[model samples]
Target: MLKIGLIGLGPIGSLHIDNLTSGAVKDAELSCVCDMRKVDNPKIADIPFYSDIDQMIKEGGADAIVIATPSFTHFELAKKCLLAGKNVLVEKPISLCTADAKKLEALAKDCGKICAVMLNQRTTPIYKRIKEMVSSGEIGKVNRVSWNMTNWFRPQIYFDMSAWRGLWKGEAGGVLINQAIHNIDAFAWIFGLPQSLRAWCKFGKYHNIEVEDEVTCYMEYPENMTATFITSSGEHPGSNRFEISGDKAYVVSEDGKLKIHKFVGGSLREFTLDTKYAFGTPETVETVEEFEGKGGQHAEVMNNFVSACLGKSKCDYDASQGVLSLTLANAMLLSSFKNSEIPVPFDDELYAKILAEKQASSELRKEVRKDFILDFKKSFR
Candidate 1:
């Protein structure tokens, strides 16, 4: 059985604990939990509890570590875990910056450890089906794509709850990084990387934060295909719909329903029966489909991570995959700030330079919540 150590007992971390002990991993146990907050579960009474992550790893006898800390601290925590010869499963976005993500990826390679990210959207069966359909020519050649994800709304209290809420230094980014990242990753999974990206963003549109709340990005691909991503945290009664048009048909997923419009034939003919003197019917027809599943995203990601740890399967949302999504997000931010089209596989140096400039200009301040930082320090000591 694989013994796991969980760091950070936040909501996501607690969810992982349940999954680890809830038969999700047939041969896994939550042998240790390290967090600043004291664990209260009776089941974990016998298990080791340490406020220090490094100390826990050294003495807990764990085979893997799940790092569910804040986004800004991912790099340091993951690096430490990998260096300690432990497999790591980090939450999404990997790191606040692309350079740090790349460095972590390289470090994982050197350590020869399993580094995975929790990009749970890729585990959805509906998205899997759609990917197969598109790749198998069922949708023919994709001509255009669009995703509108304005349903993610966050209140001011959420940002105010922690000091590292919406600023560039702490959260690193706003809707694009924290909220729309799932959709952005889904986009990359459905369609390959775009040739270039251009975006316009409104920083702190509704909230009193220093990061963007609304953004619209334009992506161009080969074969004259294009895509648009529009998202906002300020919209209420919003929409979460994705549409893709191809030569053969168009597919749409909106409000938990999937619809496809496939061309039947050329001529618009009518059929008449010997019944009442009714008019003819159109020849063309359309088909609509939908799917439902019990597994939530969190459960799916946890299961996948467990499978990967057991060598039963490989994770689709590995560290490298997370890097791709993060790079795209950083590109969007760069495009907005530079007021120019940013290319895919973006230059890491350019992003680093941008960050440095922001830091130097005092535009980005390290506004970490004192309590959170103190807790984190205590956990990592």
Candidate 2:
């Protein structure tokens, strides 16, 4: 078994505790825990709990650590563990900046320890099937990928409840980085990274926060494929829809169902050139599929991390996958901020300059607020 210490007891961290204790993850034990606030759960009533992370790092009993902390604290926390030669599983976006994320990646490689991210959306069977189909040419040359994930609706109190909930200096970014990032990760998983992008985002569109809540971006990928991504916390009764239009088929996943239409004829380009008809489309076959049952999301991520640490299996949710999502989010953000199209492989230094400038003026109100809200259920794309 892989002895584990989970740091941070935020809502997600607390949920993870239940999952880990429920025997959902095989070959794992939540032997230790550390959080700034008191963890009063019955599940971990006897496990080691520390209010200070440094103390836990020094004396906590564990072979590996799971970082379920805030966005900005990931790199530093993982840095300590990597230096200690312990495996780590960090939450999404990995680090606030690509450079910082890269540093952890290099450190993990240098230390020869397993480092994974909590991209649990990848564990979803629907997305798993989508990735398999795209890789198997079921889509046959993706030409357009558009995802409108506007279902993340947050009220003002939700933002004001925590200082780092939605600030550039705090949570590092908003919708694209925080809420709809699963979609971003899923997009990258299915389509890979794009070559260039142009984005537009609105700050504080519906809340008192200092980061973007509404965003729309256009991106271009390899082989002239293109995509449009839009997300918002401002729209109520919003919709979660993912659409991918490729040469051979069009697939969409929405409302808990997967729908696809496969073209029976040759590629559209070939048909367009050979056909004598002015405007006629090819015959197509449509299929709709749905997946049932859950697959141990967060717990599965932890189990995979433990298995990888034991050299039994490799964790696919490594720093590269983490960086891919962060890179796309950062590119969209920097592009929107500069009001210019940004090329792929964005300049990390330039992004640092931009984020620093934004941080310079950001004023996140400090307060002795409630550390944890007991209601532990929420959803996002």
Candidate 3:
């Protein structure tokens, strides 16, 4: 069995614990868990638990470490694991910034160890099929992409549960960094990273936090394509629609159903050039596909990570892929701060300065901290 060490005991972390103990991941066992809190919980009552990360790594005898702590702590924790020659898997939004993400990636490379991200959404069939459709040229030369994923609703009490829930100093960002990150990463994974971005972000518009809760971003891709990303934590009964328009077909996916309209014989360019009449277009066919069941979400990712550890395969979500979406998040936030379109791979120092300002501002504000309850089942839909 592949021995695994886990950090953090929050909702997400505890869920990982459950999956490992439940035999949801083949050939993997949760040998140790680390958190600052007392580890007498009945869920992990018999497992070895540590209050210190270093103690867990040094004495736990784990072959791999999974970091599920806060977003800002990922870099240091992952680095520690990598330097110690242990494979590390970090939760989403791999790091708050690009430089730190790259640093962990480099450390893993230097140590020749595995570093993966819990981008379980990538394993979903809807997105995987969509990626194959677009990348495989089934949707010819996609030009316009739009996703309005605003269903990630959060109440003020959710933010009040922790001082760092929606704050920039702790979580780094609000929606785009926290909830919409899966969609953002999926965007980068399917459509490729954009060349530039212009965005308008609303900080603390819906919650009593010091980071963005609402945002609208316009991104420019290199292949003469453009994309729009609109998200918020303020909207109720929101829609999760992702649309892509291409030269040969158009696609819209919503609620696990994918709809496509394809021109019969010619691409848009070919039809425009070869059409006999001014207003006539090529014939079209409509195809609809619906997907069901979570096709190996977090469990699938863990299975793959364990397989990689056993030399059966390589890690599916490497650290490089993990940082691609984070770069976009950083760019959009920086562009909103500057009130102008910013180039891809944003300036690290400038973003740090902006984040420092927000951190200082957040420190000045007084907020109530509610007791945190652990119930991972109700956390995600």
Query: How many clashing residue pairs are found in candidate 3?
Result: 0
Instruction: Assess candidate 1 and give its lDDT.
Output: 0.80
Q: 2 or 3: which has the higher lDDT?
A: 3
**Model 2 misplacement above 4 A:** 368-375, 379-381
Q: Give a tens-digit lDDT track for model 1, residues 1-381.
A: 778898988767877877777776567788899988897876667778999988998998999898988777788999999999998888888988889888888888899878888888876666777788789988777889999999878777667667566877667789999988888888888897899999998999989888899999999999999999999988997898889877666789876677877645422211223324366433434677777762357667766777778889886667888887888889899999899998887888888888766655434333433332223322210
lDDT of each: 0.80, 0.85, 0.88
| True-structure lDDT of candidate 2 | 0.85
Error of 3 at 63 (Å): 1.1
Expressed as tens digits, the lDDT of each residue in 1-381 for candidate 2 is 988899988778887898789888778899899987896788989998899877887788788999989887898999999998788999887988888889999999999988899998888888898899899998888888888888888877677777788888877799888888888888888788888999999989888788899999999988889999999989988988889888888899888789999888947667767888888887889999988854557877888888888889988888988998899999989998889999988999889788988888876768735654534456422
lDDT of 3 by residue, 1-381 (tens): 899999998878877987898889899888899998975567688889899899999999999999999887888899899998899999987888887888888888899999999998888899999999999999999989999999988888888867567877788899989999988989999988888899999999988787899999999988789999999998998899999999989899999899999989859889888888988977889999999986888989999999999899988898999988888888889999999999887787788778777777664226565565646565864
lDDT of 1 at 168: 72
Q: Give candidate 3 regions above 4 Å deviation.
A: 39-43, 364-378
What is candidate 1's CA lDDT for residue 295?
Answer: 39
In model 2, how large is the Cα lDDT of residue 147?
Answer: 84
Specify the poorest-scoring 10-residue window by lDDT in model 3.
363-372
Candidate structures ordered by lDDT, highest first: 3, 2, 1
Q: How close to the true structure is residue 272 of candidate 3, measured as C-alpha lDDT?
A: 85
Order of quality (TM-score): 2, 3, 1
